[model samples]
Target: MSSVGGGEECTVTEQQLLPPPPVPRTKMGCSWLFSLRTLAAGFSLILAVLFFHPSLHSFLVGSTDPNNPFLYVRNFHVWTRRHPQKAQDLSMGSRSALAATHFQSKQTYIIIHGFLGSSTDGWILSLKDALLNREDCNVISVNWSAGSTTAEYFLIQPRVRTVGAEVGQFLSFLEDTAGLYTYQVHVIGHSLGAHAAGFVGKTLNGTLPRITGLDPAGLSFHQADSADRLHHSDAVFVDVIHTHGCYTFLKMWEDCFGIDENLGDADFWPNGGERQPACEDGGDGATSVKDGSSCDHGMAYVLYIESIKYMPSSTHFLARQCPSWKHYNNRSCPCGHPVQYMGFNADPRAHGVFYLNTSRTAPYGLLDSDCSAGAFSLVQIIGLMMLSILLVLLLLLVGLVLIQQYFGLPILARVRARLYMEDLVWHGLGKSPSTHILNSDKAVDT
Candidate 1:
């Protein structure tokens, strides 16, 4: 307090001299971070349901009924050298389909696609084009998408068998009606379609000349009996290309989306039959999440396509009859072991679990290496270590950001409160915590 000469009094307190306190902080709640995470998780779950629900249904509810009315061959798009760009749609056992084809004793190829696949897929189209380029052969692209896809995926297996039977019946009809030989046909299938091809062979008493299984699906078929899946005995010559091999969750390092077992007379494991070079790293045990598992699975047909396209070139993939990829890596296979060409030109006589290496991109085949095991170079190892470390750091940083968003940056709050409290307490001065300054300061400390 102070008195002036004119008897006027004026007063000023320490509180008034202090700066105004900060506004109380609002409690953090779920924000954009939470919504984003929830959205991502929901999307991933939906994808998993769509991809695995059918397989899960098959596994839990076994398919005992072989005759499913819903499953049937929708159409067979027949193509020849004359009609390479366009396909002539044909119906099963229809004389029109047989007559439309320019089949003059040329090789007949039946291309089948897997679950949720159509005859118009890129690989199927490329394969059809290649086959036409190779010779004046009869190329039939089977569109059984209806049977291959359903709301209840569990029915796919039985439906696949039904479609296969229908295809078999159609071939038999061609045999009787158009003088075509069923034994001269070459059946090629991918994933579920591979097993359909097997059923086709089974219907004909295992008389088809060849059946190629491209990265056959492993979900429900991995442990299936020979009769239930594509088997070596399904055809006279069955060559399987295993780009993505299946491994249990415990063996996540050997991750893939396709069956790894030897289900054919000749089983070729390119890039160790598991991970491919072009896919994302699986160091975090998230092969499906990180890599999408497409590169490995799709590489099967890519290799086959190249095999057909580069038939005359030395860049074609050559494989060795080794017990396993490790043996091939160590060059431990017996000297007397036979060398085999993989893909479209695979020799029927060379039958075994063959292993080989491939490049990272297009033109995947190596020129001439006894066994390029695809071992990581020193630079690659260093790069992989850096990637792993970076991945860990990135995960940690994300965790911190989420925490800050929810908890209001606990570390920073604590530091600011300590400094403010120390300034007041050390100066031998204290204010009511209810004051705007103390409330705002304590909110951070709390």
Candidate 2:
């Protein structure tokens, strides 16, 4: 070897070590990320659906089960002067059983109670007695208490139509068997029962002579279509008593335990149809009188009962036609306006909205026009305005907080990041590859 010149220019092998090949992206990782994004999206979609369609919640998860056969059974307890304490059961399926009882062919009055109430409630019994004393007519108490009392309010609401249908069928049976005219029938209902009575008139082809709704329920039926809830067209004469017509907390609009809309031929609004004096908060702003807020709701039937019991001396409950309660309070109502009784003696011939005042205690009817009870002080008006504004702001703040919380989730963050990368890629693909590469390099460098 010519090793004499270069000291062991020995063979040295230089092996260039290339970096280990990048670990191939795992399918499991990509799949897990995709699944998480899909799950979050699906959950948000479901929440959105429920937020928009509220009735579906009542229909899908109602308080009463439609499959239960017991829900269909409705009992009509018939009482008269001949059988005052003892009520004979009248069934839709049976004819002879009802005929053998003390069923009369006189003016028949049907009394129906609301949610969580029974045919045997103290008020119901008292009403039955009062009606019997007033005349020798038949007093029928509808007993759907089994179905109406056991379920949640929303659950029982839809079943009111069923109750109405059953009562209508029974009335038809009376028409065929007892030879009774539809005009001779008068239906009186309280709260949810009032709407049920409306359905009854609908079932009878709007032939019922009278329908009296005592504080008809407002929750589900407030915005309902005319055909679905109590309406003036449901009967020849419909009289509505709005005692608790507007909930206090919801004063921005009329929403209450009792329906606020004038759904009858004669709409009687007592004490401005919002809160009763007897049910108002005491000076402490914490204590309520009598049955609390329910005092107002119950006053409708109480006033009706008084009208029936003291018919001769019941002129005190008389109401005057006015455009609004404010006008009535101001005594600015035009002279020669129509006037009507507020309760049981409400004349079918008289029509339009009516307003009246009542005492703060039982025997509540006022002797004269006293709109003093409805006048609002300047302080009260300012307080109410402030409260409404505060409530609106609170609701908006809560909504924003919820939205921020929802979007701040780690999964949501991952989804957003992935979407952003996809967006970049999509727009990049729209441009020339060289331009994209240049822009990306510039971004990395910056």
Q: Put down candidate 2 lDDT per residue, 150-229, tens digits, no spaces.
A: 44676678888988877888888898888878989999999889999999999998999999999998887867999889
For candidate 1, the TM-score is: 0.63
What is the C-alpha local distance difference test score of each model?
Answer: 0.75, 0.76
Worst-scoring 10-residue span by lDDT in model 1: 283-292
- Candidate 1 structure quality by residue, lDDT tens digits, 132-198: 8887788888877554445454566666777688788878777887777876699999877888898
Screening candidate 1 with a backbone cut-off below 3 angstroms (N, C-alpha, C), the clashing residue pairs are 54-153
User: Where does model 1 exceed 4 Å of error?
Assistant: 1-70, 147-152, 249-255, 281-293, 312-315, 334-338, 371-446
Model 2 worst lDDT window (10 residues): 283-292
